[model samples]
Target: MTEKQFTIVRELDAPRETVWRAWTDPAIAAQWWHPHGLVTPRDSVHVDLREGGSYAYTMVEEATGDSWPTGGTYLEVREPERLRFTWGNPGDAEGEAPVLTVELRELEGGRTEMIFHVLGIDEDRASEQSVFQGWTEAFEELDDALVAAR
Candidate 1:
């Protein structure tokens, strides 16, 4: 995959089960699933978490009273093995938003491999360094979540 629109692989120093829960369980997801310092209020999140399942949550700024809605559908969910989903940013204008798919694989010694492939975005948009930077930060948060969960 090229830098414009490609995959991100991060090896987490945690078991597959722990990492899996962080991605599947709503409570676990909220802990590390957002922009830094954003609060995931109770009852503000729901994750069906399966093939054909849907998920949604709002990121609220306690200091500013701002909330942004985001959601997506699961294309596949293989427990402790893999997860594929249609990642969408509802805040964007209709038809301009992108869709992404993710894959998770297990590694030796209680570690995990996470892969994220963002598709359905324009080449120019996909190539944007800023957007990918967000994904990098998001993955780092995921890493933190794994560590904290353990």
Candidate 2:
């Protein structure tokens, strides 16, 4: 079976710079990195936005208080345009984890079109769908954060 690859595109009302800042800035990212109902503490968010740099964040479930830590190393970083990174748990070996590529395109009237491509997923369709759903929710939170930041 082939590894799964998926892409999610979102049209955000904010400009590319604002959306980029929300993604690359740790404090801003923590505000909406997780799905709905989960909270990522600002202090727990760390970002080194550059090639070969790394980022990590901890998200706590509101009801269960469970914490999940996610970390990744940057492969390519293009300011306000693109970012490619390896994503997985903090201890994951480099190259063993999945890769995420995000592209931001500035549209007319200050809107931004963002593409999130996830690669190297080895899972069933249902599992992939769940991942997609989670990201959808997270994107919703991201939109809210962008509005609030304005």
Candidate 3:
């Protein structure tokens, strides 16, 4: 049997533009994209908010002093609406870069629904589980950071 794809969604009470900005801007990403207590030094993150573009960033856990690098290329980008990227850790034993799709839908009363999908990990259930758990916490942290930053 192979691993299965996963989808995660969160309703953020922030405007679409605000949430979009947080994802596309490196400065803002440095502050929020990473998990809480994970420090990504300023000027080390790169983001290109266009189709076919690429980005690379690092995440450092402050307490354990662990550092991990993440990089991926954009497969789709629609401002304030959707983003698709190929995501992978690059050095894992499984060596797969699952496709990550983020769809943002704007709702009335200035809210956005952020839906994230992880695909292409059909042969490694353990990896899928780990990624799912990590992303779950990461999204919650992102929501917290977005609220505070906005």
Off by over 4 Å in 1: 1-4, 90-97, 122-129
lDDT agreement with native, every candidate:
0.71, 0.89, 0.78
- What clash pairs does model 2 have? none
| Selected candidate, larger lDDT, 2 vs 3 | 2
lDDT tens per residue, model 3, 1-150: 656687887899899888888788887787765655677766778887788898888889999989988878889998888898887664643336778898889999999999888887433336534667677667777777688768
Best by lDDT: 2
**Which ten residues in a row are the worst by lDDT in model 2?**
121-130
List CA RMSD, all candidates.
3.7, 1.9, 3.4
Backbone-clash count (model 1): 0
Residues 1-150, candidate 2, lDDT per residue (tens digit)? 667888889899999999999999887898899988789999999998889999999989999999989989999999989999998798988868989999999999999999999998633346534767777888999998999878
Q: Rank the candidates by lDDT, best first.
A: 2, 3, 1
Error of 2 at 64 (Å): 0.9
Report model 2's TM-score to 2 decimal places.
0.93
lDDT of 2: 0.89
Q: Pick the candidate with the highest TM-score.
A: 2
